[model samples]
Target: MLEFKVNSQSQSVDVDPTTPLLWVLRDNLGLTGTKFGCGMAQCGACTVHMDGMPMRSCSLPVSVVAGKQITTIEGLQSKTAQAVQKAWVDLDVVQCGYCQSGQIMSAVALLESKPKPSDEDIDQAMGGNICRCATYVRIRAAIHAAAAQLSA
Candidate 1:
């Protein structure tokens, strides 16, 4: 039995240690907020916070995260997350919306790490997250707006 705390909930699943955290979160736990884009870590669609750091869940094995605190979009309650979410909504940063959750998660992590991230910081942190709808401009704007909200 592999166990981990997800979204602040203590949960356990009977699965292979090698199973990707994506499938476990989606199939086993039914937390569908984390989407699977590219199975590789490049896409960042499955991004989730492991111990408050953004990580790609699609490629990470469940075993590696055992006993770690995993926070998904649904469980994000930090001030940064709230500010990012508000900025996302206020900026209308979603196109098709498939990638917005990951974008928001990544933005939340960025804001937490650098409350006032510059363009370079936003680009570096969000570079791995690909938006099929090409919402990069809006995403960056939202991140900045979130920082502003946080600073105030």
Candidate 2:
């Protein structure tokens, strides 16, 4: 049994300790907002915040996260996150909407860590996230716009 706090709630899950945190969050906890793009961790679709760090949940084992704070898209409720969410909505950054959750999570993490990221940093940090709709350009723009809103 691995125990952890998810979205500020204590959770005790009985499963293979090696099971990826993504499965625990999705199948066990019913937090479907986190996505699974590439199970190999090449894609950032399953991105989530583990101890305030952006991680590829698909490859992260539940055991590794025991006794840590895990934040999913549904748990995000910060001024910066709000700004990013608003920018995402205002800019129409979602197409298929499948990767939006991960995109937004990654964006929030980036903006939180680096209040003002340069275009290259944004691209580098957000590069792993894939948008089938090809919304990379808009995603980058939204990140900048969100940063502006946050700094204002």
Candidate 3:
């Protein structure tokens, strides 16, 4: 049995330690907001925050996250997260909406780490996440808008 805190709640699962955290969150925990894109973690579609740092859940083993604080898009409650969500909505950042969760997760993490990120900072932080709809421009704008909202 492996134990971890997800969305501020204690959770325990009996499964292979090597099971990717994405499956654990989706199949076991029923938290489907974190999407699975590329199983190899290059796409960043399954990003989650482990101890407040953005991590690709699809490639991360559940065992490695035991006893850690894991926050999925469903459980994001921080001010930064709220700002990002609002900015996303205000900017109409969602195209296909499949990758928005991961994008929001990464955006929240970036804003948390750098409240006022530059375009370069946003690019560097969000480089790993791939949006099939090509909404990078809107995503960037939303991040900046979120930063502005947070600062106000």
All candidates: CA RMSD (Å): 0.6, 0.7, 0.5
On lDDT, the leading prediction is 3
Superposed model 1: Cα runs more than 4 Å off: none
* Residue range 24-118, candidate 3, lDDT tens digits: 99999999999989999999889999999999999999999999999999999988999999999999999899888999999999999999999
Clashing pairs in 3: none
Predict model 3's lDDT versus the native: 0.95
Across 32-106, the per-residue lDDT of candidate 2 in tens digits comes to: 999989899887889999999899999998999999999999999999899999999999898889988888999
TM-score leader: 3
lDDT of 1: 0.93
Question: By summed lDDT, which 10 consecutive residues of candidate 3 come out lowest?
Answer: 95-104
Decoy 3 TM-score against native:
0.99
Residue 111 C-alpha lDDT in model 1? 86
Worst 10 residues of 2 by lDDT: 36-45
lDDT of 3 at 25: 98
